[model samples]
Target: MRFLLAIICCKLLRLALRLLGRGGTALPGQVALRICPDMLSRLSRGVRVAVVTGTNGKTTTCRMLEKMLRDAGEDCFANRSGSNLERGITADFVSNADIFGRPRRRLAVIECDEAAFRRVCGELAPAVCVVTNVFRDQLDRYGEVTHTLGAIREGLDRAAHATVCLNADCSLTASLAADAPDRVRFFGVDAPLGGAAAVSDAPRCIFCGAQYEYDYHTFAHLGGFRCPKCGYSRTEPDVAVVSVGALTSEGSAAEVRIDGELFDVAVGLPGGYNLYNAAAALSAATALGVERRSAVRSLAHMESGFGRMERFEIGGTRITMVLVKNPAGCDRAIDYLRSLSGECTAVFCLNDNAADGTDVSWIWDAGFERLFDAGGAELRLIVSGERADDMRLRLKYAGADEGDIRVLRSQDELLEAVTSAGGEVCILPTYTAMLPLRAALAARCGRKEFWK
Candidate 1:
């Protein structure tokens, strides 16, 4: 009776929120879980599930895997609303189930928050789990990167039956494979990207306290890393990018080796970090028994999910918005911005809300210095959101002229600034700030609301 009530209430609340023009991704599931605390476990039974959990690429990885499954004629649902917590995931499952708590679709792709993974993983008992690289993120909430890693490891402990897909390039992520050795599959880039290295989140070995030596670094702490003391090293990946081809502002093409067979894959997303996402998604798809060739073909047509390299156009201005949460992601966004040619305006929107992490100190660690150093196109600067002043100050410290930075505090001011800006525009916003700013951009451009 409680299960039935939970399902009915969740559906009704979702409908109510939709009618009220709200996303209704998390609250309905929260209410449903209150009515039945074990609702997720009960509802997830008899379903084939793949859960993607980590700091950076969870949502994109889930999106890619979900698309691969759908392209192969398997009906699957995911928490596409960017609500990755327990409540939001529960809401999605309930919405896809009937009043009797039976799933309409047997297959599901879920993106789980790292902190929530420990609590949600056992309940979902996913057939396949992918852990995209771990980096320092939400320090106020998760404390440290190691703590975030511990949370994911605990989640894996609960998911004994899962076929784990790990990033062989990330030392912190590769460490988790020890928990489920026989069932583990690895993916990574075989060649170095030859970019300037930023401060590494995992500078020393997780197993031993000794500093790590790199054969070459892709960016941040990822790439071929070897611990001199304990002799720990990167494992040979089952799926790897053997060579990188053309990388344009639109997308990237690479030669990938999947299970010893080479296939030229063109990813529909920009940035080298997305190559890791593609490899992770392909690893998860293969684990789920999806055809390798069909999954590889799906990467060429992947639509951007939410704020990850999402593009919009307003009044002759081409705008690209990338969500920046931590140093690693911020550095990658900066790399993408550097890749662009011609004149462009760069906007950094930051908020110190609870959801955005109260500590804005991570901005200091991000490579804002590289943006102003040299190279790239002619760039203009705009800072907005609740912490607009802080962003401006950070850019100043990164060697920007104080007069060149425009501080726009309100949404109206930001929208006006963006629309009036000349040439291409790139906006990087923290989590809480991205919501309203993206909404305003969508409204101005006639794009669909995020919920749709």
Candidate 2:
């Protein structure tokens, strides 16, 4: 009865979402239960489930994984819109399915939120689990990075059988790798050019209390390193990304080596980090017996979803929207922008809500110094959010000048900040803050899906 009511509610809520011109993510999970009362029981029949959960990169990583599975000739059912919570996931299964509500797929790939991972994993036993990385996100909602990490450990414990795909780049994630030793497969990059910097990542050895040292620093709190005190370092990947293709408008290409064999491939996303992400996804698919070239071609054409490193055009300006929910994600966005040739206009939107976590202190951890420190063709630093002043202050300390930075409280003011910049708007926003920012950009730039 509960599940049935949940389904009915989903219908009503979905209409509301459509009317309001927003995504149906806020719909209660009970609606999912109402529609697919026996979702767990039904999944138990023969379907293999894989859950990807982390503070960052879960959506793109999961979407990439979905393409890998589909290329392997598997019927795929997934949360296609980045709805990774209980209610959102329930809606996914309930809304897109046949009346019987039975999934007709060989694989069910669900992107689980850091908070909802354990609940979803308990309800659907996944055979494979992937942890992209753990970064400080939503200091108010999550309190600390440790909380999200703990949730993942608990979720993994409930799974009947699982293979964990982990990023060797992140120290926080590498620490959690110990829980499942033999089952864990690690993937990462060699140090970038110049051999590495003096800055290190190992705050405390995840294995022993001894401080660890890094061979190189990839970005904020990510890299290949091992414990000097303990000896827990990044194990070599069974599958590794040898080279990344250009992150051009046409897409990307790469070379991946599996088991001492090389496979030249093309990937359709930007950034070197995405190379690592694609490698992780494909590596997981290989474990399921998928061929290399087919999966490579499929992923190369995989469409970029809205707001997750997605690109669009507004007037003459090329609008690139990046969802920066944490420090690591923000760092990567900065890195990508720095590499580009055109003048960069940044819209920094922050919000203090249950969804976005009121504590904006994590901005301090973000390497904003790298941005203001440069001060090149980048113009008009626009900062807007419920906590706009805080964001501005942080940037100020990072050496951003007061004259060049704009602080805005209202939505329209926020939009004006970017319009005033007179170049490509590189919009970077937090979790809940993105919806309104997207809407504003769409309205100003005349984008329908974004505005409505």
Number of the top lDDT candidate: 1
What would you estimate as the lDDT of candidate 2? 0.71
lDDT of each residue in 99-216, candidate 2, tens digit only: 4545556677788888988888887778888888787676667766778888888888887588888887777786666788878877665545211132223367665767767776
Question: Whole-model Cα lDDT per candidate?
Answer: 0.91, 0.71
Model 2: runs farther than 4 Å from truth? 1-22, 25-28, 32-45, 175-177, 193-202, 244-253, 374-376, 416-422, 440-452
**Poorest 10 consecutive residues of model 2 by lDDT?**
193-202
How do all models score by TM-score? 0.98, 0.88
Compose the digit string of candidate 1's lDDT tens values, residues 342-437. 789999999999999999999999988888867777789999988899999999999999999988887888888898886799999999999988
lDDT of candidate 2 at residue 379, scale 0 to 100: 53
Candidate number of the best TM-score: 1
- Candidate 1 wrong stretches, greater than 4 Å: none
